[model samples]
Target: MSPSLSIATTVSPASLAGTLVSNSKNVLCSLHWKNNDATKTNRNLKFRVCSVSGGYNTSVENVPFPRDYVELISQAKEAVELAMKDEKQLMEIEFPTSGLASVPGDGEGATEMTGSINMIREFCDRLLAPEKARTTRIFFPEANEVKFAQNTVFGGTYFKLDYLTKPSLFEDFGFFERVKMADRVKPEDELFLVAYPYFNVNEMLVVEELYKEAVVNTERKLIIFNGELDRIRSGYYPKFFYPKLAALTKTLLPKMETVYYIHNFKGQKGGVLFRCYPGPWQVLRRTRNKYICVHQQESMPSLKEVALDILASA
Candidate 1:
């Protein structure tokens, strides 16, 4: 018989795994975080694999989702079932662009000043000088109003007036303290406001046309996500604005912002991050006098929710 040609090979655990995983001939298995949508909106952080084959050919062993992954799923479910008791407090403000110091248009800058700090102090010292103008409508109509009213004092330009509200937008996404009123507090109260650079959209026909045709029509039809569209149809306040009413969502936006942040994920060592992407306008729509954004019915738990659930189970 011809000399026998025998050869043998050995592999370290690490080397064996690396060799198996990289080989096209070896069977491959992997699990990745995938958005429900095939397009992959949010992919998972960690991917697990047992083998590497062009197709499913490897005999896989017990490979589990990371602990955090299990928890992520659990949290997602909990978030859905748990009561979303958040209130959306819409601040409906009405003010003229170049005119108005008295009407307290939309509860923004309803206070007026007399002259200087010392002037206000001296005025408050007088019989009606306490620097208070609550009942007085001196700040409403810009021109006819007396200039001396405490609440009527402001710079001629309204540009910076709206600029101050940006910080408040960041407040809407997270925890805030309100007087826990007789209305009973909900878990989430959407505290945010919208401002207009001009008096009212309706006051300007061009503004009005742009608002309806350019803004809402296009935004609602093309821009609105499925959830937002359903809400507009339902007419939800804090979210609802009567669309039939002659109103304008002006194009000129005051340079301002509102923002919120989502933090703390279980599986994610550093925590997952979620935030609201800015939109064209902080505007909502309503028809026939009803709220539109009734919360969408939850189909399933989100990854974050599932993470929480896993934590609880553990």
Candidate 2:
């Protein structure tokens, strides 16, 4: 949101080659350029560009703009404003400290819920970078809940699966079949972003299969973003399933370069991102290998920090 971070600029149809659009939600601009190919006729292209700037510099692809470009831009602006308003409301929502105390953790604490929101935003920005566009694949098991405003920011082919309401599909071979049929993932792809709640419990078997497929199909990095750790610790997670899940992860650890277990800690306001590798049966059986906390702040660590840690660990 700071001017030093980014500045949006409007450029004419003739200046697409040199024009740079800064990464700012406020700035909605368009550009026109002609793709000149001697083999084919010269064709003019219109793109709605949103340039984001951070430690890594990259540009969004030149997407074809609709004829009602003005209306589209206006809608985008309104959506961004609405998202900001919602974020402000989230910051005001207090954490249920009383409920968290019932868990096996220490006392209560307050954390700005805005921290998690910002972290997710930063995560999307980093994953959506043009360089990652080719290798990264994002999966959101619950898609209907996604807001249009957020979808605009994470522009990519997201595999949205409605697995919660239809749990039967995941219990059998349907889940894998769906994944294979829906997305033709290449072996060269390097990163997978999975946004699913309660990842370690009921869905452990399905998740194991999913990870196996990912490792077999493409030796890529998989990061599972879970927001329901509190529920898991509150006796809601199945006790019998944990051991099986741990064993499965341990066996698959050799093939997985780095398995990141990012979740909100119990009895804590902020979230924690850690690198979890399966090894030492005693350690895994006892404490499940001490998770190396890559990012920890007052509330939830920023997504930029998580992205940097992932790169560093790699």
RMSD from true fold, candidate 2: 18.5
Best by TM-score: 2
Native-to-model Cα distance after best TM-score fit, residue 39 in candidate 2, in Å? 48
| Candidate lDDT (C-alpha), each | 0.22, 0.34
The sequence of per-residue lDDT tens digits that candidate 1 reaches over residues 132-174 is: 2221111111222223332344333121111111122344563
In candidate 1, which residue ranges exceed 4 Å CA deviation? 1-234, 237-274, 278-314
* Model 2: ten consecutive residues of lowest lDDT: 278-287
lDDT of 2 at 9: 42
99-163 per-residue lDDT for model 2 (tens digits): 21122222222122223333344444433455655565544443332343245544443432223
lDDT of 1 at 191: 18
RMSD of each: 23.2, 18.5
